[model samples]
Target: MELRVTNLACARGGLTVLEGVSFTLRPGHALVLRGPNGIGKTTALRTLCGLQPALAGEVSVPPESMAYAAHADGLKATLTVTENLAFWAAVYGTDLVEDALQRMNLDALRDRMAANLSAGQKRRLGLARLLVTGRPIWVLDEPTVSLDAASVALFAGVIRAHLAAGGMALIATHIDLGLDEAEILDLGPFKARSPRDGGPASAFDEAFT
Candidate 1:
């Protein structure tokens, strides 16, 4: 299966920020989005996950085929690392909680409450959710936000393994992941022009401008 975004247009606050964005991600491949802040990288990703409707174009992927990880760690502070993974695994109907714990190096911290884990450790735990998801497409937004160099490398290895196993990832990150299966897509050229440049600006557009 492949994830195809064709002539896509994504908006935020009712103002289009990216237009004519397109790419194809086949299994065992990954695509990294590159752009300045507010260029709609997250907007594009959110649209793909059905968090918001695309202003135009189409995204073709199987239903329930994507897993999204944003800034939120999505952890319950009261739960231990193992319990948290178990919770997500149960939600996703998977039995890979133990495996996720092992891969994320949380085996020792399994009994520790999420509130007690370090920021990087918590990020690792949150990303571990992807493992139990059983989804082929991973749509991540700045996934390395609080990770240290070593932790970033650890997570990159996880992503590499996922790609090697016929999975696809669409990541919006500033860090260079150095994955051989990856390609880059710059959203600069797709930046939306001001509505006033083409037509009268809508009141909503004026607020953002």
Candidate 2:
């Protein structure tokens, strides 16, 4: 499967944040979005995942084949780790909870309540949800937020396995994810200029360009 974006424009709260964004991600590949905070990296990912509409241009990717994990882990505090994966598995019509548990190295803690897991463990559980979804495209936002060195290595291994199996991923992160040969999409060039910075000539402008 391929994710193609052409001249995409994104806005938040009626303000344009990114414009003329475009990229193509093919099977077995990954794209890392890099930029400073508030540069619309999240907005672009949201647009790609269909959580929000793009203000302009086109995004072509099958929704059914995509799985998105936001910055928040989104785990139910009262549920066991296994239960959480099972719940998501049922929702996605897949039964890979056992495999996901083992893949994320959460087998020992599988029966523990999500509330009892450390931040890193919870993040791993959140990532494991992607495995159960049976989707080919993974959209992750700051996936390594709380992971230590070993945990980050583990996550990288999982991503590598996915790509080896012809899966694609689009990730937005400030830290290096250690994915070998991953394409980079820096969002800096796409940042929209503020009107006060002489972006476009307007009647209200004291000095029009």
Candidate 3:
């Protein structure tokens, strides 16, 4: 699978936040979005996943081929770890719950309720959902939050396995995920200049001129 973005512009709440962002990610590759807070990394990820619309430019990636994991862990509190994986498997028409469990090192906690899991465990379960989706592309936002050093290494291994299998990932994070070959896209250059700053012109304004 190939994801291509060209001169992409993103906005939130009717205000432009990023503009002129472009990148191409092919199968077996990863692209990391790096920048300070409020620079539109999350907005860019949301736009790519079709949760939000781009203000301008183009993004070419099939909706069905993408799996997205946001910062929040979207697990059912009452469901067991295994049950949560099974539920997502049903939704995505996949039967890889056991595979996901093992990949995320959650096999031991499979029978435990999500409510009883720690923050790191919940984050791992959230990540395991991406594997069971069977999609070729993954878009993750702040995926490593709440993870310990060991858990971070485990997550990195999972990402490596995904790439080795010809899957692609687009991640927005501040921490090092240990993915040496992944391309870095610093969103600072693309951050929208505030209209109040009296800069030459906002990227959004320049786009139309």
Candidate 3 residue lDDT tens string, 83-201: 99999999999999999999899999999999999999999999999989999998999999999999999999999999999999999988898897699999999987776665345
lDDT of 2 by residue, 1-209 (tens): 58899999888766788989989999999999999988888888888778888889898866677899998998999999999999999999998999999999999998999999999999999999999999999999999888989988898999999999999999998778788859999899988777866564334443553
For residues 1-209, write the lDDT of model 1, one tens digit per residue: 89998999888887788889988999999999999998989999999999888889999985489999999999999999999999999999999998898888889999999999999999999999999998999999999988999889989999999999999999999999888898999999999888767844658867778
Per-candidate TM equals 0.95, 0.93, 0.92
Q: What is residue 194's positional error in candidate 1, in angstroms?
A: 0.4
How well does candidate 3 score on lDDT at residue 19?
Answer: 86
List where candidate 1 sits over 4 angstroms from the true fold.
Answer: 206-209
Error of 3 at 56 (Å): 0.8
Report lDDT per candidate: 0.91, 0.89, 0.91
Top TM-score model = 1
Q: After TM-score superposition, what is the CA distance of residue 195 in candidate 3 from its true location, in Å?
A: 2.6
- For model 2 the local lDDT of residue 20 reads 93
Error of 3 at 157 (Å): 0.4
Clash count in backbone of candidate 2: 0
* Each prediction's RMSD to truth: 1.7, 2.9, 3.6
* Candidate 3 ranges with C-alpha deviation above 4 Å: 196-209
* Worst ten in a row by lDDT for model 2: 200-209
